[model samples]
Target: MPTTQQAIPFHLAFPVHSLAAARSFYGELLGCPEGRSSADWVDFDFYGHQIVAHLAPEEAGHRQTSAVDGDAVPVRHFGAVLPMAQWQSLADKLRQADTRFIIEPHIRFKGEVGEQATMFFLDPSGNAVEFKAFADIGAMFAK
Candidate 1:
């Protein structure tokens, strides 16, 4: 049985145009450590989760979006919830790197339930990725 104190790890597999680009984006830029790899796919330790990038150009990138909080949020995306400071640091790092943001780092739902600092950006293959943080973690899932 799983313990409440420890969240279970998750595995995600997504398509990428090129394995080299995935390595550079996920491994070098995002700092996700590389794991098992083969000619067609590569895995990264994405913040304690397993994320595999398979070589499939036609299946990559996010096309549709949904309106949310006055922003066009990608319809299909995945991300992690970091602590406040860590989120800030990553935001700063991405800024310094001149990464193009889908949604620039900002606090949403201010003074309301589930208020959080969040950002959205794309990987080299145009996969939308989001990173967010909550000042009060308990508010994360609150309505």
Candidate 2:
């Protein structure tokens, strides 16, 4: 049997079109608690990780997508792997905020490997995030 690994927190920086809108989306809509901030950038505790929104118009315009299970999955996306309950809570919270989703939160691969609750949404800066969770941790990377 393999030992359970400890999940280390991380920090990520991504481009956004508007700092103010990004602030509201992450800090208010998504409910990520606020951290540090400046006129050009803002930080949030994104599911236990530090995610900074930087004002970069050039990077915000382009989006890359790929075909996955007949769905056009955003190629340039980042997200946290949360516990099932936490993931459900986030989905509920987003719905309550009237947040629009690129992909509705749903279970993928029912009764199969890598089955998870997944959803995609763009930040105010246009950066994409796909939050997901596996019911069985051991099957997180199953093929």
Among these predictions, the greatest TM-score belongs to 1
Can you tell me which runs of candidate 1 are displaced by over 4 Å? 1-5
Using alpha carbons, what is the TM-score of model 2?
0.88
- Candidate-wise lDDT, in order: 0.95, 0.84
Error of 1 at 60 (Å): 0.1
lDDT string, candidate 1, 32-106, tens digits: 999999999999999999999999999999999999788899999999999999999999999999999989999
Report clash pairs, candidate 2. Answer: 16-125, 17-125
Could you give me the TM-score of model 1 versus the true structure? 0.96
- What local lDDT does model 1 show for residue 25? 91
